[model samples]
Target: MFDVEFVVDIINKSGSSVEVKLDDQAKKFSQIGLDSLDMFNVFIELQDATGKEFSDDIVENLVSISTIVEFLNS
Candidate 1:
């Protein structure tokens, strides 16, 4: 259980909404039609939305939506 809903909204706003699932977390962002910049944008939006700061390490682990939720909830 994590901030999946918030992350989904971010993903949607980032550009595309591809119906992310826990299983998608193990795959790369491109696998779901997003690029690295889009992911970075999502993180930036997240930072703005939650007032939380994220490190570069978060990007490394953000290969999938599950990982994004994990990092957001963290």
Candidate 2:
């Protein structure tokens, strides 16, 4: 299951918040306040937590927390 709390915790640990709902808007990497380094960190954390590798294409196209949840769930 894709728990929101788990995701939020990761975001918080990355020194950010998932409080903003990206559900309505198209979420881009830059829009989420994740720079290239942050993006790498996030990917690393996600992989560590879920044992799933997020591809560069997905990283570039991410648009929301929901999208991330979907990716992790997959």
Q: Best-fitting candidate, measured by TM-score? A: 1
Judge candidate 1 at residue 3 and give its lDDT: 67
lDDT of 2 by residue, 1-74 (tens): 97656766676576443333424234665676656776677678877888886787877765556678877776
Candidate 2 stretches with Cα past 4 Å from truth are 15-29
Off by over 4 Å in 1: 16-26
The TM-score obtained by model 2 is: 0.66
Tell me the lDDT of model 2 at 40. 73
State how far residue 31 of model 1 sits from its true place (Å): 0.3
Error of 2 at 15 (Å): 4.8
Ten residues in sequence with the least summed lDDT for candidate 1:
15-24
* Per-residue accuracy of model 1 over 1-44 as CA lDDT, tens digit each: 45666677677776554555545656778887787667777878
Per-model TM values vs. the true structure: 0.71, 0.66
